[model samples]
Target: LGRIQIKKTDGTLILNSLNASDSNASIKGLEFDKSLIKYQMYYSGNAECNDKGYVYLFFPDPNNLNQMKLTFMQEPDIIVSCPSGYKTL
Candidate 1:
């Protein structure tokens, strides 16, 4: 199980790893910044982007940071199109 927190002002979110039935998972209030992903995509050589592909990011609870669980699920597709002369390049 996981928990999510969002700051209403700037769309900031903090995701915690407190599951419903898991009693051993605690992070001691470990938090992650959204910029971590952005930097990885931009500067850090941790991630890469292609014309069509998938991206995955994961963080563990501070207490169980060493433990990991991997799952796969299907998500809805999102589409964005430019209007008029707008360009994404």
Candidate 2:
């Protein structure tokens, strides 16, 4: 699996791939208040394709709103296929 980190500073958005293999990932856009972070990612080789997705961070605790929790969403085209007995993860 690959990992990425998103950051916002002075109205600027930054995306960093925690692993070298994920360097192709990049941010497409973001909401003004930084409530949403959108990015597009590409997959090749065994899982050849591309998709768009977004990550949102929410705070569950009303008292500690500074806490962070992450959620990821993506709607991919049906062009992707996995080998028999294997599933997308």
Candidate 3:
């Protein structure tokens, strides 16, 4: 199943978010695949458990949809905010 494999600075993996892609996100995911992966960025949101919060940044790949990774933040403080349609990955 599709999942968010949260990672850490010390190179650990954790399951932060267990959310399935909504209908719209499923379609949007396909579109995201078609576009070029041009940047390295991060997105932050509330933590899942005892952890403060987390950050997910796109792991780069050349035309590969499965090429992604997450580096979990012990204290996921909001670093920045983007526009409505702007995506971190």
The C-alpha lDDT values of all candidates are 0.30, 0.46, 0.40
lDDT of 3 by residue, 17-74 (tens): 5565543121112112234433322323322322233333465664677876544445
Among all candidates shown, the one with the greatest lDDT = 2
Which runs of model 3 end up more than 4 angstroms from their true locations?
A: 1-50, 76-89
Backbone clashes for every candidate come to 1, 0, 1
Q: Lowest summed-lDDT stretch of 10 residues in model 2?
A: 38-47
Q: Each candidate's TM vs. the true structure?
A: 0.19, 0.39, 0.28
The predictions' CA RMSDs to the true structure, in order, are 14.1, 10.4, 10.6
How does model 2 score by TM-score?
0.39
RMSD of candidate 1 to true structure, Å: 14.1
Query: What lDDT, from 0 to 1, does candidate 2 have?
Result: 0.46
- Candidate that would win on TM-score: 2
Error of 1 at 25 (Å): 31
| TM-score winner between candidates 1 and 2 | 2
Query: Measured by TM-score, how close is model 3 to the native structure?
Result: 0.28
